[model samples]
Target: MNPLALSIAVGDYDRTRPLASGAVRIDGVDPLMIFLTPEEIFFRAFRSQDFDVCELSLSSYCVKMANGDSPYVGMPAFLSRAFRHNGLYVRTDRIKTPQDLKGKKVGVPEYQITANVWARAMLEEDYGVKPSDIRWVRGGVSQPGRPERVAVSLPADIHIEDAPEGTTISSLLAAGEIDGFMAQKVPALGPGGHPHVGRLFADPAETAKDYFSRTGLFPIMHLLGVRRTLVDKHPWLPTALLKAFTAAKELAVGALTETGTNKATLPFIEQSLEQARALMGNDFWPYGVDANRKTLDAFLHHHHAQGLSKRRLSVDELFHPSTYETFKS
Candidate 1:
């Protein structure tokens, strides 16, 4: 038998580095990894429909994919610590409270992804600000001249573009290039909070809980999705992939805990724990079928409200229930 191949997509972040590492550890082969901006991932996926399986931010991707009229199936849940999408930060000096963001510029790489959308929703829902109230700027892959990339039905003003990742956004924030930005929570804080920067929203664990409570949505930080036809052809592929990833999550968690206080990887481990608490609450389970379904339903409803999709995506259309059942049973 040939070694099974799976293609995975994810943000270029250090925390997610374990996914690649775990792939090698388990399969003895490196999964096909595509590193790109969130926007590029969506465009590439929609245009070419390439790759047997791909990972993506769950909420935003669901909106875009469903809007494009593609019938792609997403994993029932995020891969453990991989689902923490509630990290949004801003310069503490500029935007002290969420309400202070009025007329200010907030940067995000892509709006179609959950980070931006959920952040916006939180500001509006929690803080009581209209999405159009802020000055949306698009920061491209580079720091200098990226403008906002607008979504189909989103308010025209609710978009901005900036440097590709949080590192650049962090730099821009430190230098006063941009007011605020959203990124992974653990990485948002460094030794002394970036000198010139202050955090506006640093409670990813809290945000995750609040999101689940308010919207019944578990913001998917990363997802493993297969093309519909490939799923139909290879029924076992999804199960095998999920099993490998779930095992990877466990190993990653164990490795982090065992290496506690090592100084080198302690921060990463701590951050992972924060994310785990957020996603799974006190008792964390990497694979929780009930929670996963609830999240899916929330995501579908959000997309529908935004007018991104005309119809609600059924659980069957979005995930392989059998995969979860097989794993649990």
Candidate 2:
């Protein structure tokens, strides 16, 4: 039989680039790749189930999974992962620390996005600042009128309001209308940028590194997902996807480790690679549930606590059964 024909929608990241360029191929699959921004891929996928295989927001997926509304089953291939300590922006004159955020109005693109979830969780977990500690302002970080991708019913104590009509959080932040801003992407305060725009953490990299040392959570943002109906029809597909995506990430890792020539354009490629390995081990950006159980467990608990999920989801329920166990060599 001909290989399964499918459309794979994901970002053009180095790890996924191999699959998109055909250097990596899923077993018994013929995939048409569509590279897109995270917002685009998630908006279309969650709204319409637009692709056979897609990158899904981890928090949103858990929300759907808990509600039994998800049309997709997760794969262990985390398409995006990052330490979100650097994602929080604040006013230089005020909000010097996470605790200072209490009672302050902070802007977020969405309350349920993985980056915000991790940042908020980190703030509470490490700094003892709860989500209810701060009033939330939801709006577009850079643009105007971006709504929550997935609807959420947060606890009564958690207060959130939309940005004013025709105005972005960035503008509110620049003009000191909002005390802080939080999102994965950088906020454009204005053409030259505002003098007051700054990060809550004075040294985010050091703080993130310290957090990683304390808690081995790198914080996964996105994971690969296939439609549940398709997975039901092709039981072998989840494992096939996991294998190919792992292979693709391995190739990207190899390129990063090759110090003879810089695979990435950054100046400290070799130092950065060594530092990452030192901090998180050789398999720093690991795939598979077993390897990432701690990370997933923390995220799930935070997801439930923050009211993103209907209930706390276990790590076992996050991925399909086929992805849970692989053949032993």
Candidate 3:
């Protein structure tokens, strides 16, 4: 039997680098790993079904799954995770707190992006701000006239308007046309920066730490998606890919723990890691369904509530059956 050929596209992160460099090989597979920006990868994957396996926006995946048009069955390989507290930016002069955002004009690159979904969920759950309370402006972060990558039918009460032609969200934000903006890749603005824009949270790292302590969720942003056709054709592919990703993650973590020379450039790598462990536990960046049920369920509820996913999806419905288990020794 010949090894299956698969094209896997993901970000060039520490966890996935091993797979691209051939240090970790997928069992019974010839993997063609392409490391690319999430924007490029996602545009191609959802728009055209470009790769055999690719990193996908969890929110978009949920929407597709709910619509019953999903081309891929998910694997539990969460390649991207972040705390979205830092992604919320507001006009410092106009919006002093979360409460100030009520009945305000807020801009978003795309309402369906995972960061915005998580940020909105956080605001509603923790600060008593609801999505329908504000009028949303939608546009590109940097470019003009960008369209939503996928179509979504939102509830009637949620108000969203497109940006004026030839303008971008950054410009609207800078001009104070929108009172605030929530996006994953918000442009830089601060004291010695664009005078009008500042983070909603002054010290985002500290705020994120506090949020984690309260909620116990380090939000997941992206997951590995295998083309459904491929999965149906190759029943063994899910387990094979999952095994390779698991090994690659272990290798990356091991490399980080080698204290003699830091794998990453930032100072206090060791201390930073210890702090994360203290907050999140030993397997801080865990993969798979059992360890991540709470986080996944929370996201599903938020997704359904926000009108992004038409129906609530359980964690068990999100991934291939093979991804939930491994062979017993």
Candidate 4:
């Protein structure tokens, strides 16, 4: 029989596509139900109610609320890795340092529940500049004649209207249309292509190390969560899925390495590996039991201190009960 239907909300399905098309026939898994983005999974979880299990980031307050003794519960995974929120890219001719960002307009997609918050935190903690220090702008995937809109919350800031995917943002930076923007390095077009624009942050590796040293909290970029009802009804679901995904991630790592380096995709793959190592160590186990608890506890304590949450939610309550027991042994 085919494996049960499961869904994950993340980037393109390149890694899993091959498995889905193969004859391996994932036991109790359904390849057709996978989702590519968190937004799609969120809407479907609430609307269609079709999915038996879903993946959500641990940092997301929405997932926390949804699992608050409700119908859904979170199954935290230590093996899962966090990706860096690629830093602000700017025109090399304009801004030289984070200090120069004062009064300049910066663009971000989601202000609140995004890697932007962590990126901003790093800037403030390291550079002593608060959010009020810069002109902020909000952009999205929808805009007239453009794939996204440029919406400014601050006054007198130049509007960096939506540009097409590859050339637009780079061109804007090159032409001085917008001061800077944040994006993943995967699709990064180096200064070679856009002459004037270059990365502002010097070394992401050192920055991440410093952030962890100071805060002892690693920001979670993605989380694999299992639904509560499913866990309660079928105790084996969480472990089974965890094992499957862990295996899949290993396969992905191998596939990535075998593909070698292409100018276009090398940066993304390298950065992803870096992130994976930071979050899960070199072993790349996507479902580590002990690591998840440590990371989750640290995150909850930090948020609680910031007055983000009232009290600490127990890991047992958040994750599958079986997971807790499995970790204890």
Question: Which candidate should be chosen as best, given lDDT against the real structure?
Answer: 2
- After superposition, which runs of candidate 4 have C-alpha atoms over 4 Å from their true positions? 1-50, 61-72, 78-85, 141-178, 184-196, 205-219, 251-281, 284-286, 301-317, 325-329
**What are the C-alpha RMSDs, in order, of all predicted structures?**
5.7, 1.0, 1.4, 6.7
Candidate lDDT (C-alpha), each: 0.58, 0.91, 0.91, 0.53
Residues 73-137, model 2: lDDT tens digits: 99999989998888899987887778988999999999999999999999898898899999899
lDDT, ranked from best to worst: 2, 3, 1, 4
| Residue 285 lDDT in candidate 2 | 91
| Best candidate, TM-score | 2
Candidate 1 lDDT over 1-329, as tens digits, reads 66656676655544346666544242433477666665566556655766656665566456655565554566653642323333555667677777888887766555455555556656776788656777654443233443333245564444444454444554566677777766443323346768546557577556557666676554555576767786787777676666666665555455555654542433566766677676557446445456566655655665555444556666556667656664355
Deviation from native of the Cα of residue 313 in model 3, angstroms: 1.0
Residue 75 CA displacement from its true place in model 2, Å: 0.6
**Candidate order by TM-score, highest to lowest?**
2, 3, 1, 4
